[model samples]
Target: MGARNKLKELRLPKRSEIERFVKQRPTCGMEMLSFLNCLKANQFQDSACVRERMALEECVREHQSSTGSGSGRKRKDTLMYHLKRLYYLQRR
Candidate 1:
């Protein structure tokens, strides 16, 4: 079968099941595979994740533009430092 048809054939649990799963985990305990499977099975096409990421980028841009001085440069440097730290930690 085609990928699209296969995705449509998959079955996801009801909303209550999702709520129960979240309540039980309440942290980074949820399984990524399960979540992706659910999305694929349901053929969900919402771009909320992309939208939220874009919003965060816009906020950062605005902050940088408003503080066009040494402070703005410092803010970017700090962010880059933290991101590098996170990347290294993830690699380990």
Candidate 2:
């Protein structure tokens, strides 16, 4: 491999893009993207990529099997709901 290629670093996709994708589909693949993105943001260079990638994969698997957080859905009990309730206080 060329020296440049070896030196060439990998980066996570943009947060906005990742969020959009994850919102659409919160698959292991999507979580993988997020994990990698986080690794890059934390300044994890290529040397640690293999290790980090493995961790990413593990995280993806865990996320796929579980709904821990960040479900990417509009919450039902938002401020709008509360505001409406306040504006139209019904007699008990």
Candidate 3:
């Protein structure tokens, strides 16, 4: 059986739950995106927000690098593409 099947059999949380967990963990995706959106809308003038955004981006970069599959560069590119789209949609 595939990894997904195994995970299902084990009653593991689905991908959405995992993503939600990742987002909710302190200093993670939701926080970063919130900070970025605030910055883009000129809601805050704090330089710390920029730093937070950069840190989040770095986390995502490292995650993509570490978990990337065959032809790592391709995986990274695909992840970036999806992330970019998600970020833009969140801003809207």
Candidate 4:
């Protein structure tokens, strides 16, 4: 059984059951993903990508947190990914 199924089988308390959730519904998420991608694509070749990615990252984080997902079901850090690229570029 999956982890959630196992949790259910154990008859855990409501707070202890560990419900899984996402920042946004599938359609909303797809829309946001596409929009973010568009923002990152065809940048100015310098700070544009990083700057836009950071803004997108903050929006995603704020949306997810406002949904009460908290630390759970949070998506991967795309902002960090952009920051890493910027760091490498600066280092070169």
Candidate 5:
């Protein structure tokens, strides 16, 4: 009712605004792929792929710190970020 109407009235970001925040390739893509490959090669035995898993974790941490995403906020490149933002806006 009223809440739905208010939500519908809220202005959404333009396509260009969202596009700039979108990442063509995820951060640490290579490290992630390497980890997945190792897991597959090891027959999905996590114990046998500790090194690859560690490498991927390190890559993700480095990327998060470099991009200032270590603060626990959702990355703007993710759809979840926009959705949550919109939800909050509607609540306000």
Candidate 6:
């Protein structure tokens, strides 16, 4: 009965629970696309896209600062983190 209770407590997390931790798109995604498009339109000339590049860089910097040095879910609860924790617990 004690072992059975332990097994019940060790049940795997639901698929939806894990899926909810999926990483979101970057805040600067639009800026990145704009920069890429600018480069492509100008025959891949870096000089032609300098303004777009600057805008993209600024967006990235702003995002990084807002997100505490760009850790971006590194220390947050994520799907892989959940799985690894369960794996180790089950192993023991």
Pick by lDDT: which candidate is best?
A: 5
TM for every model, in the order presented, reads 0.25, 0.27, 0.33, 0.30, 0.51, 0.52
With a 3 Å backbone cut-off (N, CA, C), the pairs that clash in candidate 5 are none
Q: Give the per-residue lDDT of model 5 (tens digit) for 1-92.
A: 89878797887676677677764787788888988998899899989989988998998888888777778675444686777778677767
Which candidate has the highest TM-score of all?
6
The CA lDDT of each predicted structure is: 0.50, 0.56, 0.60, 0.53, 0.80, 0.78
lDDT of 3 by residue, 11-72 (tens): 33445665665553543667577767868777677574776777777777766666663245
**Residues 1-92, candidate 6, lDDT per residue (tens digit)?**
68756865786766677676565776888999999999889999999998999999999887777667676543354667777777676666
The reply for model 3, stretches above 4 Å from the true place, is: 1-28, 37-48, 69-92
Rank by TM-score (best first): 6, 5, 3, 4, 2, 1
Model 6 residue runs over 4 Å out of place are 1-23, 70-92
Candidate 3 weakest lDDT stretch, 10 residues: 69-78
Better of 2 and 3 by TM-score: 3
Model 1, range 1-92, lDDT digits (tens) per residue?
Answer: 47656555555555466556545333222343444555566576435344444555565566566667536454333544564555454444
Give candidate 2 misplaced runs (Cα > 4 Å).
Answer: 1-48, 68-91
Model 6 lDDT, full chain set: 0.78
Off by over 4 Å in 5: 1-24, 72-92
**Model 6 TM-score on a 0 to 1 scale:** 0.52
**Lowest summed lDDT over 10 consecutive residues: which window, candidate 5?**
72-81
How many residue pairs clash per model? 0, 0, 0, 0, 0, 0
| Clashing pairs for predicted structure model 2, backbone only | none
Among all windows of ten consecutive residues in candidate 4, which has the lowest summed lDDT?
A: 13-22
